[model samples]
Target: MVRDLTALTTDMSLQEAVRIFSMTRVTGLPVVNDKQQVIGFLSEADVIGAIMPRSRDMSGIFLSDFGEIARKMGQARELSVGDYMTERPVTVTEDINLSTVSETMLMERLKTLPVVRDEKLVGVINRTDVCSKLMEDREAI
Candidate 1:
C-alpha cells in the first residue's frame, strides 16, 4: 500500500490536474471531497478524452485539422477536474486481501484504487504494489 498519495479536488482546473499528472508520472488520481472522502477518479485517458475530438483510440490522431485540436485544448483549460472525473469510482478497503484486490482491479481494468478506511481516503494501492507483495510472499516461502 502506498501511504504517500497525491489527490486532486473538484475545483482544480484541468491544467493543474495535467501538471500533477506529469510531475507525479501517474496515470490517475483520486478526487477527494472537503472531508477527504474519495468522490471520484480522474485518469489521463479521461482528460485526453475530454480535450481531444472523439476517436476510437485515445492516441489515434483522427483530428487532421490542427485548428480543431487547438480549440479543444483551449477549451480544456477552462474546465475543472470535476467535469472529467468519474463519479462514484470503484474503491477498496485497507483490510481487503491482496488476491481480492488484485482480482477486482483486473476485472475492472483499474490501474489504481483508493484505499479507504471508514469511507475516508487513507492511501492507495495499484498493480505494482500488489505484484511487489506477491514477490515478497514468494521469496519468504
Candidate 2:
C-alpha cells in the first residue's frame, strides 16, 4: 500500500493550498476537517481556475492585450479552498483490489482517491501511483 501523502485541512485557504502544491510539486490533496477527518479534496487545476486571468474583449487587435491579462491576474485575490474544494470525494479502503481502483478511476476519470480505514484518512492512490506500480511490475517481468 502507498504511504507517502500530503494532507491539508478544509479551513486552509486556497492561497495556502496553492503554496503547498507549488512547494511539493503535487497536483492534488486530501481535505481534512477540524477533527482531522478527511472531508474533501482540492486539485491544482481547480486552484488555477480559481486564479485564472479573465479574458478581455479587445475586439481590435492591440499590443496591450497581453498586458490586460497580466493585470487581471495580478488583481486576483488569494482565494479560499472552501470556495473550490470538492466535498465528499470518492475514497476507498486499503484492502481493495487494483481492479476496483481501475474501474472507479476509469468510470469517474478521477486523478486521485484517498485511502480510508475505519472512516479515517490514511493515504492516497492516484494515477501516478498506479503508473509507478505498473512500471515496477513490468521491470520485474
Candidate 3:
C-alpha cells in the first residue's frame, strides 16, 4: 500500500482536483472529510463524464469541436468534487489479506482502493502494488 497517498476534500473544485491528479499522476483519489474519513471516490472518468454532454441531452449535435469541449470544461471548473464523486466507495480494511483485496478490486472493477483503519483513511492500494507483492513472494519461494 502507498502510505504517501493524496486525498481530496468534498468542497474542492474539480479544477483543483484535476490539477492534483495531473501533479500526482494518479487516476483516482479518495475523498475525505475534516475527520479524514473517506466519504467518496473520484476518478478521471468521473470528471470527464461530468463535463461531457449525455447522449440523451445532446439531441444529435456532436461535441466534436475543440471549442465545444473547451466550453464544457470551463463549465465544469465551477463544480466541486462532491458533485461527481462516487459516494460510499468500496474500501478495504488495513488488515485484509492480499488475496481478498485483489478479489474485491477485481469484482468492483477498481484500479485503486483506499485502505482504512477503524474507518479512517490510512493508505491506498492499487493493482501494481498487488502484482509487485506477488512477484516478491514468488521470488522468495
Candidate 4:
C-alpha cells in the first residue's frame, strides 16, 4: 500500500546509511539484496546503535542509571549498520491491505517494510510515511 521506499545494502558502511538518511530527509530505509529483495531494515535506531557505544546499562545505579547510561552512550560508535541491522527482517506485499501493513509494522516494532512482488523489492512503506498520511485524516490536532 506504500511506495517509493528508499533502500540500502547491508555491505554498505554505516556512515553511508546515515548520510542517505540525512540527505533524503527519511529517518530510515530498507536493506535489500542485489536482487532487490528485502534483507534487513536500516533505521535511525539501528544507525544510533551502530554509532552508539556499547556500555553497561547501569540503569539502576545512583537511584536509576539514566545518567550513567547516557554518559556511556556519548562515547559509542564502534559498529556498522550491517552489524546492527537484523539479518532477517519482516516483509510485505504490494497487495497487502493498508490496515494490515500498519498493523504489522506496529506489532512487529518495524521502522520500514519493503514492498515485494514475487520476491523482488519494488518499493518501501514506512511508519513515518504512513503516519504522515494518517495525520491528514485528523480534522485538528
The 0-to-1 C-alpha lDDT of every candidate, in the order given, reads 0.88, 0.76, 0.89, 0.72
Candidate 3 matches the true fold with a TM-score of 0.89
Which is superior by TM-score, 3 or 4? 3
Instruction: State TM-scores per candidate.
Output: 0.90, 0.75, 0.89, 0.71
- The candidate, 1 or 4, that scores higher on TM-score is 1
lDDT of 2 at 129: 79
lDDT of 1 by residue, 1-141 (tens): 899559999999889999998999888999999889999999998998787666546566764755677887887778899989999999988889999998999899999999998778999998899999999999999
**Clash count, predicted structure 2:** 1
lDDT of 1: 0.88
**Residue 106 shift from truth in candidate 2, angstroms:** 2.0
Is 1 or 3 the stronger prediction by TM-score?
Answer: 1
Ten contiguous residues minimizing lDDT sum, candidate 1: 54-63
For residues 1-119, could you state the per-residue lDDT of candidate 4 as single tens digits?
45575688877777677778899888778787888777788788876654444453565235344564565455333335567787777888777876787799889988778788887
> How big is the positional error of residue 32 in model 2, measured in Å on the Cα after superposition?
0.2
* Candidate 3 ranges beyond 4 A from true positions: 56-68
Error of 2 at 141 (Å): 7.6
How does candidate 2 fare on TM-score? 0.75
